[model samples]
Target: MAAKAFQPRHQSVSRGIAFRLVSVGCYSVMAALLKLASEHGVVAGEMLFYRAIFALPVVLVWALRSGGVRALTTRRPWAHLGRCALGIAAILCSFQALIMLPLATATTVGFTAPIFATVLSVLFLGERAGNHHWLAVALGLVGVAIIMLPGGPANDTAPLPGVAVALLAALGTASVVTVVRQLRHSEHVAAIVFWFFASSALVGGILLLYVGKQHDLQTLAILAGAGFAAGIMQITLTESLHATQVSILAPLDYLQIVGALALGWLVFSELPGQSAILGGCLIISSGIYLIWREYRPQTIARRNLEANTV
Candidate 1:
């Protein structure tokens, strides 16, 4: 038999971009499925349970393929526990918001995660934000406020409770991102992902006992689909981050807003009001500018010089 050629693991910006877009599409689909299930009277806890349960097999397969079962082993159990708790809370709040708000509105509000993350980095990581960073953060907050402001045109308003929940979800997500930043120093990506799914499944399972409700087969299928899509999205996103610079991939995340807008209009007959569109633009522009600023060659060189001088 001929010898098989070994493939080298090399970064490909194009592939990373494609992977990111696919991941965004998968997430959009998952959100749509969750919304559909919610409409069928599925509780947020139950939806989370099924999402984690169905996603377990896929995450296991990913972990096994990335390394072996041993790759799932972790030395930082406490860190994972904290991350899982926050992640589960974020998921619960996100699901609740999705059920109550238009899809685009929920998604637009969720974009605040990066802005929250920036502030958290300053406070927790002792990282200093430049004037530009603070400017971006302020602009992003303004955008969030615009969306959350009361009494827009009738078609543009979302429930205050839903908006509040979504903002909470974004805060939780930012905290998760900050923790993951620390975890990446000590944990393999596969191990982190595996433990997250396992912990989430356990937590969701326990919660299910209290809040789970019966569902028709179709609703069950949709819930399962949501779980499956979430797993795929996670995998693709991980791969995308591995395959390219984060800045190259970061702006691509905004594509989800477009996907959500389209899905909302087509699937739910929901159109984002003026406030959402305006706020989304501000948030996305600020995020992209931050990413560009952080990744520019001059900024990179200056940071490296500072480190060397220190």
Candidate 2:
């Protein structure tokens, strides 16, 4: 039989975009909260450890609602654990970056996760990206250069280690995204997210033993808020995924720059220079354009495939 047409009857494309925007908004808020906590001297490991603790129960409920506990016991234990490790590393690096750099600048650099994800997908998943993606990659590199140039308006000597950590975070996160693609066919999204909290908690706790500082209840409460924010971000991300393809949702991730910039200015009194703003805009535009080019056709095809499957 011929395949059916791929049409989204329940949720319109605009709705999908709105959902993704909400998700990105949550992510930006979460990033701001993490940055705030860090300024008070919270170590990345400690911050993540607390965040994971708060997230575990919420994610557990999600896992149960999605597919019960069976979904958690996948045959691919190693893959899931590896993904969790990568997530922890990414959070650790990102928090470090946030602490050392201006909120807007650090966030702009960390937004490179999508590009890294694309490269990893091509290398590891054998996914074919067209010329537009390559062009996006090249332009993204230029954006990075603009942001990273020594003595640039956005440049800060303090963020050197943090910059390295953020790059490492990008690499690790890209690998996790590739792993997610590999497992998407078999694994439930909630299960993956659940493992993220569970594993990060356990691993981050172990790591925190070395660097953890004693904080009073009020400080602990603030740190715990980071976890709650992380949970909300994860839920938002998953819900957005349910409404649209990653490629469609990916561009919305750039909205974090706006939220971060605004929050940085309002809360932290930090402002992005003209160059930083211009470079961030170039990077975000290139990424969004590339994702749209690659995913628009593929999303249509996937919808058609689903219609036929039904």
Candidate 3:
């Protein structure tokens, strides 16, 4: 294993914003196409195989270009395994939610990860949370409830199962974040990425034996695009963080919801109800506040201490 190499922050907020914006687009497209594939009869487990396997070559090429093969080596294999496992579970949940719910609704629910992350820090990192943190978490839950609540018409649709799974996805995502943050201190970005896709593809390949089904050419193309978009999103997302504070970029993430809304309407003929809109607003506000709080000077100091202790 190689020691971590140091690089200075890019310090260009404009470039960071651009990367974040692109990342948001890729993520939106990934989720949208993922849902489209599901409508074509692809299951989440099968899509997970496509998402991981197709992204492997892309990640590998990028890893080689950015650094030699050595950049793919890691000091902590177990951490990478754990992160990959969490990622697979989180993505499966997200895909399941997308299949069961509308695009905008699923995207909005996914944003609740920050709320989960806040609680994770307090519980596992020995960070003391103020009342505001709990308030933010409560707001996030209220938003989810509003989204899941039945409204108007004959009530033919029930989204409770999807919303519940989406919340679990958010928790899985937060746990992955904690492990990845720790890994970044000592592992190269390329290493963290390479092993993730590599290991996930391996696991997904095995699971494919039970869940895999053939797709039409059109559906295969959609899954391939989704995989590429996911890979690009991962790369650009990491670069964005290297350039600026996550708090500054956090608000821009809501742009994905707007994108999701457009895709849901234009592609799937789905429109979010008033409750979904209101709930989305609450979830976004909660996520933004949680991210902002995490970046505060006082909080960052405590976080640093927590990291050191770990």
Q: Pick the candidate with the highest lDDT.
A: 1
TM-score of 3: 0.93
What total of clashing residue pairs does each candidate reach? Answer: 0, 1, 0
What is the descending TM-score order? 1, 3, 2
Question: Which window of ten consecutive residues has the lowest lDDT sum in model 1?
Answer: 1-10
Worst 10 residues of 3 by lDDT: 150-159
Residue-level error in angstroms, candidate 1, position 308: 6.7
RMSD of 3: 2.3
Candidate 3 — which residues are off by over 4 angstroms?
1-8, 151-158, 301-310
**Could you give candidate 3's per-residue lDDT for residues 18-91 as a string of tens digits?**
99999999999999999999989999888888998778888888888877888887788888888888988987
TM-score of each: 0.93, 0.88, 0.93
**Looking at candidate 2, what is the lDDT of residue 224?**
71
lDDT of 2 by residue, 110-212 (tens): 8677788878878876667778888898787678777766687766532456666766777777777777766666666666788888888898889788988
Candidate 2 ranges with C-alpha deviation above 4 Å: 1-15, 298-310
lDDT of 2 at 159: 48
Q: Tell me model 3's lDDT, rounded to 2 decimals.
A: 0.84
